[model samples]
Target: MLLHFISDLIRNPELQRQFSRDPEDTMRRAGLSEPQREALHKGQLEPVMKHLRAELASLELFAVVWVKAVVQVGSTQPGIAAPGSTLALQVLGDFFTTGAFAVVKLEGADLPAVTRSVENPGQRGSVLSCTLDVPANTPMGVYDVVVVNPDGHYGVLPKAFRVE
Candidate 1:
């Protein structure tokens, strides 16, 4: 029952939105066990993923990354970065770590790079700094950046930035 609820939550963005607003009510209505409900309320994933993995022989989980902003390394404003320069994407999610990676899916190209930390891990909130290397020849247009975690779960920032 918990697995079914989780699957629905993953596939439906509307449900996710509602869950964010009222997690306790959502989990209760979904009939999750006490432990599972508590785990979710605390933003813990290990136990939930363990149960999910057991149900499916193999799985590639798809998750969400709450992107706070996408801007240049030193700029506070969002959007518009130079080609061949580094950009900083501030994101809030539990799946971020040194092991995570990202890809900028531009119209004609894909930029994949390892993520780096701009602030000390224990100092700031759950915000992570991902590096984006906009190619010199990348078309001057908006692009979507997708972040993939070590567990194969991914989240995308649709039309996240523009190259100038």
Candidate 2:
């Protein structure tokens, strides 16, 4: 399933890097069908939506390949961050220099706005981060990170973040 590939890319940094460098090679290794591979290679989400038999908001939007989750600066470890800390996630996909956005949500509730690091546009991957800014009265629990590119493509990290 496409979600499985996305999950693998999110959990495996090496695979993420490989996907960013050569998507076709990575997809092939993942055992994706020719059509699925072509759809993803072209960044077309309609076929994937159809393949999954689900209706998505952006049928033409491109798909993003999540590669790494570095919760804090200079650390590859993901999850288990305290409130008010910056969390960084790396992804391989298409995004506009302007108009792209991300967010952190818990239980279908949006937590706070995420800031996308404007690294070199030529960089191999996109790094997005957010500060857990839930109010002090907010309950402590796991949260999910969602990214939306300028073209309206969305990718959610399956791994949850634990607040301590």
Candidate 3:
């Protein structure tokens, strides 16, 4: 089925904004869609893998949640990040007043999730940016951006790209 993100986001700013607001608001908004949220729904490896494949940015080894639904990742490449490098994550979606989703974090080996401008939101800069400091000993492999909130709300958006 064809899903128009912009339309859906515009029609339901609150729905989208919730993803970018504080942890409570994010969880509250996520609760509204728990029945259909992919991140929250329990699934198998293949299904979850497939979902991550489609919900991740090949350009980036990872991605970060934007206003509420968008993710601006880097260009995809093999071994793009050298040891002791900083990974950048970005997103652009509906604005969230409480600021870019509370308690936003990334997961990976020897990596630190760093989020700036939390107290002072990105101001809907047509996009949002975050960073995950990769340890000097970070291993090389595929990864997923798992966004979660305090109220048990979470979702993983599509982030795929083509090399050819």
Q: Candidate 1 — which residues are off by over 4 angstroms?
A: 1-78, 118-125
Each candidate structure's TM-score, on Cα atoms with residue i matched to residue i, is 0.44, 0.40, 0.33
Pick the winner on lDDT between candidates 1 and 3.
1
Error of 2 at 31 (Å): 39
Candidate rank order under TM-score: 1, 2, 3
Write model 1 residue lDDT over 63-150, tens digit each, in one string: 2222222221221224567877877665554444445566667766787755676343222244456666777877787767665555
lDDT of 2 at 84: 53
Q: Of the candidates shown, which would achieve the greatest TM-score relative to the real structure?
A: 1
Note the residue pairs that clash in candidate 1.
Answer: none
Candidate 3: segments with Cα more than 4 A from true spot = 1-80, 92-112, 118-128, 157-164
User: Which 10 consecutive residues of model 2 have the lowest summed lDDT?
Assistant: 67-76
lDDT of each: 0.61, 0.55, 0.38
lDDT of 2 by residue, 1-164 (tens): 56668768888999999999999988998888887788777777787767555322334322332222222222113556566555554433333234445555677557565554634332234454433444544457776656665545555665455566
How many backbone overlaps does candidate 1 show? Answer: 0
